[model samples]
Target: MMEKAYAKINLILDIVGKRPDGYHELKSLMIPIDFYDELYFEPSDQVELISNVDIHNNAILKTVQLIKDTYHIQRGVKITLNKRIPLGAGLAGGSADISATIRGLNRLWGLNLPNRALTQLANALGSDTLFCLYNQRAVIYGRGDQISILPPGKPIQNITLVCPNIPVLTKDVFGVFEKAVAHDFEIVYNTYLVTKKESLLYNDLLEPAFKVSPKLKDIYNHLVSLGLKPHLSGSGSTCFLFDLTEDQKNLLKNIDDVTIIDTQEHQ
Candidate 1:
């Protein structure tokens, strides 16, 4: 069984409130994009896992072990992860890959789980896992598992992402949002809700994300300077410039450690 794990972007993200579980409540439009990591499940005689990236870091290996202990399943899956999405870039590459793995293994091992059951498994790994399971444009809330799929709306135009050769920890970016330093969420939310002639895109994580990683800020500002609507993907590091011109794509080729991925607005 092979699973293709996709990457997602938060077209608009707002930390609405703090949850009772010490996690912040959030509202965001999440869209899975073209970038993906491939997972191949090989059923073998022995229980084992392998990946090009570190096995300790591969979520498939770790989650499989967790499922094994919890379910006492008879079958085992040998996983091979081909990591393409950059790690720690606010892309949810890790979580998405894990979600894909869980989905793949369920079938390969003959678990015959329903979507809801798979989603329950997703929640055990991370709140964002459920979004990955759906792999469509959705409005996510309450720790990111409470997803409501939206009807097909305006298609997203072209966007280019530039990720500097550095990692931006998603947890650290969220910490900045919750700290006593204070930030404005109301203004951003107001901006997000306005339906427009074109697609409305915004990321509340931008200000604080750039604060920690100035290079990421540089990329964001650079895009804005060029009259492109720019937003940070997920938490930080990956900055997306929307509706680009041919010249912009040509210019993007000159940047270091950047990849141009075609993205769609999931509705």
Candidate 2:
């Protein structure tokens, strides 16, 4: 069985408040992009994973163990992952993998677990894993487990992403995060609703992410210098721009030392 795990970008990220449980309450718009990782599964006597990239403290392993214990399954499987998503770029690569594993194993083992069960498993794995299970454009709330699928609007097109080679830790960024005022969130949200302008979108985590890594701030300023308005995705290291012209796309290609990803290009 093969499963595709699509990476996600947070177009709008707002920090509502810090919960007592240490997880910050968030309201963000998250969408899965065309870029993805592939996982191939084969039945085996023991659970084993082979991947193109080395992920420390892999959540996929935990997900597999969770499913086995939850369903009381004695069977094991060997999984091979062709990882394409860039790690720690504020893209939910790990969460996507976890969700894919859940789905892949469900089909492989014929568990027939319902959506609710899958969601429960996802929620336990991480904040963004639940969102990956659906892979739709949605507004996520309350530490990212609560998902509200937005009414279908125009599809996002000409999406270009600039991912710096550095990795930014989400926990590190959140640790130093300063919550934005409720008024700021209201204005940004309302403005985007009315205009559908990418520039109107806001990320409360940007300042904290910059604080965690000054180099990210430097990159942001550099993009601005080139007359581009880039919005930070999720926490840090990756910034995205929408509706770029052909000239702007070429300009991005000339940028040194950054990975450029374009989405929704027509053949």
- On lDDT, the leading prediction is 2
Please give the distance, in angstroms, between residue 158's alpha carbon in candidate 2 and its true position after superposition: 0.6
Estimated TM-score per prediction?
A: 0.87, 0.94
Q: Which stretches in model 2 have alpha-carbon errors above 4 Å?
A: 184-194, 265-267
lDDT of 1 by residue, 12-64 (tens): 77776677888888888777877788988888766677678773555677788
Q: How many times do residue backbones clash in model 1?
A: 1
Instruction: Give the per-residue lDDT of model 2 (tens digit) for 217-239.
Output: 98888889889999998987899
Q: What pairs collide in candidate 1?
A: 137-266
What's the CA RMSD of model 1 in angstroms?
3.1
Shift of residue 249 alpha carbon in model 2, Å: 2.1
